[model samples]
Target: MRFASIGSGSRGNGTLVQDGDTCVLVDLGFTIRETEKRLARLELAASAITAILVTHEHIDHLNGVGPFARKYSLPVYMTPGTYNREKIGLMPALELINCHQSFAINGFTVVPVPVPHDAKEPCQYLISSGSSTFGILTDLGHITPHVAEQYSRCDGLLLECNHDPDMLAEGPYPYPLKVRVGGDHGHLSNSQAAGLLSQIELSRLQHLIIAHISEENNSIEIVRKEILATLGEWQGYLTIADQGTGFGWITLN
Candidate 1:
């Protein structure tokens, strides 16, 4: 099993997870043209993707889903609320997923864990192929007990470290937007990400990718200092998935 990212931030977000011949896209935030370009960087073509799984209706995650799916004639899976909340035009193949259920997509087993975000039916994914499990969690406010337990074991994880509380509180966003971001239904802060790291089984985690960072409210340096402080002497790889070029493909053997 292996995974790579197209981009990770408020502007756009997409992740690719593959096992053998089956390659699935978690979300599509870029235009069809941009998605193709980004895929080319990873030596991939859009037609090679097996399916697309959507987490929510947020523009940064749903923008390119319809166009890309229609162009490629690919199957799309998402919760019904997410599909109904947004008019993404006509989808050639759409599958409605239950947030609490685990389903199969080709060789991968996808577990959709519901998250507390400001969306209709937002959920993150835990994808497993063979013995390697990869978890992707983002755009959620706080970590629930269910979330903690579900993500405790993974070979690779893409965890959201969206902002620093101090920076967000003093940033240029409007008062309501700041409150929304720092609120219970908003993105996770760096400290919160570290706290979750402290709870999970870090020994089994081979790679940890920090994702969905706020361009206006957070910096890589700040997140590094904070997360590294929590990581301490942990031996796993720590990678930051930036808005521009999300990290390259990392394999799980």
Candidate 2:
């Protein structure tokens, strides 16, 4: 299996995961044109994607989902609440996913895990094909036991390190906004993300991509240093997803 990110930040987010003949997109936060450009950067085309899995109804994650799906005649899977809350322009194929249910579309298996976020029935995803699994956990405030269990055995993970508490506390965001971001239902701090990493079994983990960083309150240097320190003795490749370039494809066994 192989995975790559289109972009990761408050501005927008998208990830492409492929196994054998099946390719899927998790989130569509850019316009059709921009998505095309990003895909080209990775040597991928719109027609290659088999489906789009939406995590929530946030604008950054929903901006181009409907249009892109319609344009490509691709299927979109999300919770009923998220579907109802989203005002996507139009869609040709849409499927409402039930939280906690395991389903397969095309040749991939999807496990939707519920998350606590300020959205209508938001959920993160764990995708598997053959013997490999990829865990994508972002835009959630806290990690529940269920989440920890589901993600503990993944071969590759795209974890969110949205901000640093100290930077956010002193950064330019307003007081309430700061509180919300630092609260239990906003975003995960660098420490929180690192803490989750410590709990996962790292022996089989080949790559770790830190994603969805806040451009206004966090810097790559800050997150890199913090996460590197947290690694301690674990041997794994680490990469950061940028708002513009995201990251290149990394394959797992």
Candidate 3:
């Protein structure tokens, strides 16, 4: 299995996961044209996507999902709550997923784990193909015990390190917005993301992609320092997903 990010930041987000002939997109935050252009950077076309799985109704995650899926005539899966909350129009193929259930799409097995985000029925995805498992967790304020357990044994993880607490506290997001971003239903701080490493099994983990970074409130250097400090001697391929270029594909054998 291999995965790549189309983009990752407060502006937009999208990830592509594939195994052999099966390819899926998780969250498409850009417009249809922009998404196609970004996919071109990864040497992929819209028709190559087998399906689209959405994490929530947030614009940065759901904006392009409907248009892209509709254009490609691809199936889209999301929780009912997410579907209802978003004005995504009509889709050619729509599948309502239960957050607590694991479902199969094409050749991939997808497990949706509920997360405590501001969105109604927000959840992250754990995708598995053959012996490889790739987990994506983002937009949550804190990691729940259930989340910790679910993501404990992933082969590759795209974890969110949204902001630096100090920077967020002092940055220019206004007081209420800052409180919301740092609140229990907002985003995860760098320290909070680093703290999760202690609860997961990273022995067999291969790739760790830092995602959903706040351009205004966080820096690559700060996130790297905190995560590296938390990881200590652990040896894993670490990559940061950028807002413009995102990151290249990393294969897991």
Please give, for residues 118-153, the per-residue lDDT of candidate 3 as tens digits: 999999999999899999999998989999999999
The prediction achieving the highest lDDT against the true structure is: 1
Candidate 2 structure quality by residue, lDDT tens digits, 1-253: 8999999988999999998779999998999999999999999988989999999999888888988999899989999999899678666877898988999977789999999888989999999998999999998888888888889998999999999999999999999999999888899999889888888898878899999999888888999998989888878899889988999999997
Candidate 2 accuracy as TM-score = 0.97
- List clash counts for every candidate, in order: 0, 0, 0
Where in model 1 is the C-alpha error above 4 Å?
A: none
Q: Any runs in candidate 2 off by more than 4 Å, and if so which?
A: none
TM-score result, candidate 3: 0.99
By summed lDDT, the worst window of 10 consecutive residues in model 3 runs over 195-204
Which tens-of-lDDT digit does each residue in 7-112 have in candidate 1?
9999999999998899999999999989999999999877789999999999999999999999999999999999999999888899999999999998999999
TM value for model 1:
0.99
lDDT of each: 0.94, 0.91, 0.93
